[model samples]
Target: MELTLVDLSVARGGVPVLAGVSLSLAPGQALVLRGPNGSGKTTLLRTIAGLQPALSGQVTGAEDRIAYAGHADGLKAMLSVRENLTFWAAVFGMRDVEQAMQAFALLPLADRLAGTLSAGQKRRLGLARLLVTGRPIWVLDEPTVSLDADAVALFAGAVRAHLAAGGMALIATHIDLGLDAAVLDVTPYRVALNGVGFGSSDEAFL
Candidate 1:
């Protein structure tokens, strides 16, 4: 499946964040969003995932076929890892919950409460929901946050495998994802007051 974001703009408390952003992602393609903090990368991902309202753009995709893993690691803290996975699986209508847990390497921590798991562990469990959902489009915000080296590699490999298998991904990350995906520097896409491009902080051309 393909997704497109056209003429996108976002604001927080009446302050402009992202403006005139447009992007297209197709199957077997991944795009990394790179920018410093407060650069609107996360906001763009959230808007595309339909989590936050888009102020003045269109997100066109198969709404039912999209999966999002945000920065916060959205998991039920009160439930065990297994329970959290099971709950998300049910929400996404997965056929086999055990397989999904095992895929994320959560079998050992399955019995432990999500609240008690380490930061890395929680991120893995949150990402594991995508395995269960089998969505075509993945919108991830800082997917590798708090992950150890091994977990980071695991997440990168999973994303690579997903793209290889004809899935689309929009990743907002500061670190390299180790995938042969294209880069969409949102920094340049930001408009400037005059035609001089003061808001474009992307250094690629410098």
Candidate 2:
């Protein structure tokens, strides 16, 4: 599968953020969006995931294959770790939680309440839900917050496994996710609203 964006324009809060962006991603490939904090990385990812509408232009090739994971973990506080994954799996029409449990190292926390896990542990459980969704295209926004070094490695391994299975991923992150992904700095596509639609700045993402 492949996702192609041609001259895509995206906005947040009814204001243009990213304008005239174009890119293409194929199976087994990953695209990383990098830019300053306010450079619309989240907006662009949401647009690609179909969570929000685009202002203009076209986004093609990605239909129902998108699985979006935003900044929030989206876990039920009272539910156990396994319960959360199983719930999402059922919602996404899957029955297997074994892979997801091992993917994020959630097996150790399987019986633990989501509310009891640390921030990093909760993040892992949240990410594990993606495996059960069975979607081919992953749209993630800052997926590694609060994760320790070991957990980050585990996350990277999961991504690589997904790619090996011919899945594509689009991630918007500050620090590295450890994937050898194509980096697209969105700084150039940002639209400034100083009563005008275009401008330039010197801030680059690290």
Candidate 3:
């Protein structure tokens, strides 16, 4: 199934940030979202991931097919590396997390508690959760936040493998992962203050 967004308008804190946004991603494809800070990249991704409501338009073919990894690591601090992956796998009705663990080089740290892991290690473990999800579309926001150069390459490799296996990715990151993917700049879709209503609260969650 192809993920399609048509004339989509997404809001942050009940205020419109982007409007007239549209895109489509078929299997084995990836799209990188680009814009300055506070340009609604996170808001758009959250809307597409079904984490929030869209102010207008449609996001079709993405009902239960998206695996989203936002700013947070989404890890259970009390669980060990192996246990964390196992937990996410179970949540998605999967069992084997060996591949996921191996992909991120977590074998050596498998017995380590998530809270005791270094920042980069924790991020890797979080990204590994995507593999066990068995979802077709990956919606990631700054996925390489705490990753080092080598860790970034590992992520790139994982993404490449996922694409080779016919999965799609929609990422919002300033760093280039060296993937031959299409880029979508959301600058044109920025809504003027007078064009849409503004909420008193900021989009702090982003």
User: Each candidate's TM vs. the true structure?
Assistant: 0.87, 0.93, 0.95
Candidate that would win on TM-score: 3
lDDT of each: 0.79, 0.88, 0.92
Error of 1 at 126 (Å): 1.2
Tell how far residue 113 is off in model 2, in angstroms. 1.1
RMSD of each: 4.8, 3.6, 2.2
User: Could you give candidate 1's per-residue lDDT for residues 1-206 as a string of tens digits?
Assistant: 57988899975444557788988899999999888666777667777877678779787884887898875688888999888877877887776777667666889997999999988888899888888787989888878878888888888877878888899888888888778989988887653434333234432211
Indicate which candidate wins on lDDT.
3
- Residue pairs in collision within model 3: none
Residue 117 of model 2, lDDT score: 94
**Lowest lDDT 10-residue stretch of candidate 3:** 197-206
Q: Candidate 1, which segments miss by more than 4 Å at Cα?
A: 191-206
In angstroms, the error of model 2 at 108 is 1.3
Using lDDT as the yardstick, the better of models 2 and 3 is: 3
TM-score of candidate 2 versus the correct structure, residues matched by position = 0.93
lDDT of 3 by residue, 39-112 (tens): 88999999999999999999999989999999899999999999999999999999999999899999999999
Q: What is the lDDT of residue 50 in candidate 1?
A: 76
